[model samples]
Target: MSIILTVRRIDIEETLNTTPSVLPQIKMTAQLNEDRIWIDGCFDFVHHGHACAMLQARRTSNNKENSMLFCGVHNDAAIEYNKGTLPVMNAPERYAHARSIRWCSAVVEDAPYVTAPEWMDRFGCQYVIHGDDVTLDANGEDCYTIMRKMNRFKMVKRTYGVSTTDIIHRILTHNTLPSTDKDYFPTLDELEFCSKGVDGFSNHCYVFQDDLNNMLVRGGYDWDSTNSVLILGDFDLFHMGHIDQLKKIRNVLEPRRQIIIGVTSNESKEIIMTIKERVLSLLSCSFVDGVIIHPSKDTIENSSHDEKSKFSKVYNIDSPELVDGTVFSGYLTSRTIIARIETQRDMYVERNKRKGMPI
Candidate 1:
C-alpha cells in the first residue's frame, strides 16, 4: 500500500492523563505467558540496520514462537535533548515507520530517554536490547547503564555497511559523493517523487532517476521483471488455514513471483495479543513471504476463526506504475504497486481460480 498522508488524531485525554503516577497503571496486561523483547532508539531514519537489530532482538527470547518485539522510538524532543539535533523524521513519522517494519511488533509512542523499570514492567519486557555500538546521553552517561547494572541488557552486532548518520551525510554531500559509495535507499518522499515517471522527466530528472536505479540495483531488485501479489489480512493467530491459503496462491505462482502479506494494525477491543505479538505469529508461518503493517482505521473484530476465513482475497494489480514505480513498492526486495484496499476489509476471493493472475 502507498503511504498516504493523513492527519492522525491525538487523544488529548490520554496525552494529559499520562502522569508519572499513571505509568504504573498502563501496564500491558496481555502476553503474560509470552516474552516481550524491548528495543529502544531514535530510529530517526530507519534503515536496514534498524531492521537487523529488531530481528536480532526477536531471536533473543527462549520461545521464538512466543516472543514479541516492542520498539521504543525516542520522541523528537528526547532526540534533540540527548543528541544535540532533532531527528530528520519527527516522532510520529518515526513511530509509523517503525510500526511499518515487519520485525517491530509494536511501537511505543513518545518513549523517554531513559528506560525506567516501570517501562519494563508496563511492557512486560525481560531484557533491554540494543546494538553493540555505544551511545551516551548529553551527560556522557551510557544510556543503557541502569539496565546493564540490573542484568537486563543484551547487545546485537551493528550492521557493518550503513547507518542513519551515514545516510544523512550522503544526502548532504550527494553532489560530490563517490560513485562506489552511492548506496542510500530513497526515503518515501523521494520515492513518491520518482513515481511521477520518466514522461514527466527533464535533464535533472534523468540524473535523479539514474541515482534511483543505482540504489535499486544495489538493493538487488530487478524493477522491470519482478511480479508481486499482495495478500492482505490480520493473520493474528496465524494457523493452518493461513498456510493453506498461501499454498493455494503459490500453486499458481509464476517465475519471479512474490507474495506480500499486509497485516492489519487496526486496534481490537478483544485483542488477545499486542500488535507486535500478532506480527510475530504471522511471521512464524512459512506461508507469509512478506509483511506490511496496515494501520486499521476502525476497530477490528474479535479473533474468531470464522471471521479470519473471510480474509481469502487475492488482488491482481493492473497498473505497472503502482507496482514498479518505487523500489519500496511491492515485495520488500523490489518492484511495487500501490494497492489501497484494506487487506482485511473486503472478501473478494475468487474461489474457482486457484492462482492469482498478473493484472
Candidate 2:
C-alpha cells in the first residue's frame, strides 16, 4: 500500500517577506496562552482519517481535557482553485460534517485554503495542526509555509490505507452491492494503529455482547439503563446523509434521551468500511452518545427482550422517521456515493491516478 507523506523545504527569508501578518503583536501575545488549536482542510468525503487527525490535534495541548480544537473547512471556490476540482461535498455540508466530530470544539466555515497566521490569531489558536502530507496552493507552494515560518504549525502522522481518493477508487472498482465473499475487514495491526490517539479518551468503540459486557464492567457505558433513541444501520461510509439523519433525530428527540447507534457487524453483510471503522466514525458524531456493535440479522432478532426495552424508539436507515419528505433528499448513502463514482468512473480513476494511487 502507498503511504501518504510529503516533506517540503522552505526558504525562511522569502516566506517571511511574502506572508502578510495581520494580527497585532499585543493580540497575538494575549492569545498565546489559550489552549485553542486550529485545523483547516477541504474535508470532502470526511472519514475516519479526518477524525484521527482531529483526535491527534486535540492531544497536542498541555491539558487534553481543556484543549479546544477549532476546525476550519475551506469554501468551494478555494478548494476548486487549489485542488483543481470542487469537493464532493459543498462548504456548508463539509462544515457540518467537521463540526460533528467529537474532538472539534468549533467549526469555522469559508476558511482560506492556505493556512494564514492571521486566521490562526483570529481564532486565538496557539497552534495549527495538519497531517504530514503537504497541501499545495494554486500557486504550487506549500499552503502551510506561512505558519511554519511563524512557528505555529504542528504535524500529525497521516493515517495510511484510506483517503477520499482511495474511497472513490473503491467505489469505481467494486460493485455497489455489499459482498460477503470479499475480505475487506481491517487487520489487527491496522486496528491497533487507528486506536493510538484514543488511549486517554473515553472508550466508545465496542464489540457485541462479550466485549460490551467487559466494557460495561469497566464503566464504559454508564447509561445502559437510560431511555435512549436507538438507531441501527451498516453506516458503511458514514457521510453527510448519516450526519443529517442523526442531527434530525437529535432535534426531534428530548435532550435528556441519549442517542445510541448500533452498528451491524460485517460478518454477514457487504460493507466498504470495517466494523471498527464504522464505530469510530459514529463515535465522532456529536449526536451519537454510544455505539453498540451488534451481530447479524439472525442474532439481532434473537437478542434478549431486556436488551430491546432499553430504547424507547428505534430507527434504521430506511425508516420513514429519519427521512425528510423531498424528491431531492440531502442524504447521501454509501450506495449513492458508490453509484456516483460508478457513473463517473473514468474521471475518478484519472483523479486517483493523479493523486499517486496505483491504478
lDDT of each: 0.47, 0.65
lDDT of 1 by residue, 1-359 (tens): 11111211122122322222333344235232225678889886555567667766776766644456667878888887887656555565566556645455567767778776556656667788888888888798988899899887888887665555443332332232322343322343333222221111211111112111222112123322125445555543232334444544555443245454555533432222233433433433323344444422221222224432222334432233334433222332101101211231122122101123111
Return the number of clashes found in candidate 1.
Answer: 6
Badly placed stretches (over 4 Å) of model 2 are 1-30, 175-221, 265-270, 296-299, 302-310, 325-331
What TM-score against the true fold does each predicted structure earn? 0.48, 0.78
Q: What lDDT tens digits, residue by residue, belong to model 2 across residues 1-359? A: 11111211122112221222321222223345346778999988888889889888887776745566777789999988888777776676687788767677667667889987766766567688999998999899999998899888899998776688877766666543343434344444433333332222555333333223433212244555336666788888888778777877777644666776777755565566755567667766767766666644433333444664445666786466676752213556677777766776677777778888655
Prediction 2 global C-alpha lDDT:
0.65
Candidate 2 residue pairs in backbone clash: none
Superposition error at 71 for model 2 (Å): 0.9
Give stretches of model 1 more than 4 Å off: 1-34, 175-227, 230-359
Which of the numbered candidates is closest to the native, going by highest lDDT? 2
